[model samples]
Target: MTFSPDLTETLLRPLLRTDPHRPRLTWYGGEPAGRTELSTASLANWAAKTAGLLTDELGVAPGAGVRVLGLRSWQVLPAALGSWWAGLALDLSAAGAGFADAVFAAPDADPEVVAALVDESDPDTVLALSTHPLALPAGDLPPGARDYSIAVRAHADRFPGVPVEPTATVLQADGPLGGDAATVADVIERARALAAGWGAQPRVLAELGVTVRTTAELVAAAVAALAVDGSLVVVDPASGHAAGTVGADEQITVSHPF
Candidate 1:
């Protein structure tokens, strides 16, 4: 039976929570070169197989937590999903964020550990971890450990992950970017490009959309508010505007525009 996401986390209590490993996040550095796809189906497959290692093989308790950190490789995608499906409280942290990243109850692993994530997570809350690789600001990051990066195609792209709540928090955090008042045209243009990958009538996921004319800015704000979990902060255009206030708590999954 497809697990009902409606169950208040209280009754579910995470004892029976989980996530799939494979979900692709194409990697891009300076310019576009090649692309990679990390599908959820593949992630879930590996997550389930790996959990067998920890539970039936190694004897990691029912609710163990792991601190995850690493390079911004696409591999982190599966590591996060795998951790969740195994019923573990996965703590996602950046590599050099700060001292806070180094704390108790956090295990550090690269994205390669995707499907195996849940096996390590049990008893404790099954926290999800993911990065949208968007050019946006920082959103709510699951407080945990340092980050890392591994070579691409290190492990098998096949993992069997468990089905999770539809509304369950999947991925978190975006790389970084700048804010210089975009125009409505730009907003629409980006929405156009995003539509190429996501869908035609895509909904933006964001919090603040200040500028007036740019389509990227306007549609960005609209899509975020309409489709994703976000809030629209209407600011006074006359103030000349300072840098957009970015909070780890207020951000959504995708990164801001470039």
Candidate 2:
């Protein structure tokens, strides 16, 4: 498969055309009930809805910043991809998240933390995910926040917009290692490099909290899998399952601490 340098072109379009029904992401939360699988077509649909939410409802323009707060979960997939679809820079670090144009938080996050975020960053929009296994609407949220599960349902499955420019910054992070940023082109290149050694159709296993600190790392892992016409299996340490166990169960071809 020819790899496109563009983030969306590389990650979504090609896979949708070639293998839309193939499972691209399978997340295990330690139990059968916690498992959530998304095929390329389904993932793209959610991403499109998320992009519509940001662009049409929130009025977030291309090149804006979107703060994403959450552990590694199935929810992060759409949030990351959707942000990219909308041409927004994804800020995975909490250091200056409040200053972003919008914020997306996990459903089970502490209310105090959410309140503090609202107070500190005072962003124009705050979206809280339900994180429901079935993608149901969340019950309640912090003041001034909207339920992403409900809001996103109203958006179309296909995003009605042009793809983002390759030079646009897609990810930003402030980690213990240091502050980092990458453009769309940079992300594609990094993903290609990461997958270069992995054989064809590599099924990559990556754990959140264990190996991934920023959403950018997860994105890279997913893109790498996509580039090879492969798949990504994500395990959250919080799920209480060992990475090796999940990797074995998924028959992963490669494991990377992205």
Model 1, CA-based lDDT? 0.31
Please list the C-alpha lDDT of all candidates, in the order they appear: 0.31, 0.74
Residue 214 CA error for candidate 1 (Å)? 28
Cα displacement (Å) at residue 131, model 2: 2.6
The candidate that wins on TM-score is: 2
Off by over 4 Å in 2: 1-6, 30-33, 107-113, 120-124, 174-179
Give residue 226's error in model 2 in angstroms: 2.4
Which one wins on lDDT? 2
Tens-digit lDDT string for candidate 2 (113-224): 6777787654447888765567777566778788888888999999844456655667775542124677766666666776788887788888876676565566667767
lDDT of 1 by residue, 28-86 (tens): 22112222333334433434443443344334443354344432223333443444444
Q: List the candidates' TM-scores in order.
A: 0.33, 0.84
Candidate 2 has an lDDT of 0.74
Give candidate 1 regions above 4 Å deviation. Answer: 1-24, 28-34, 93-258
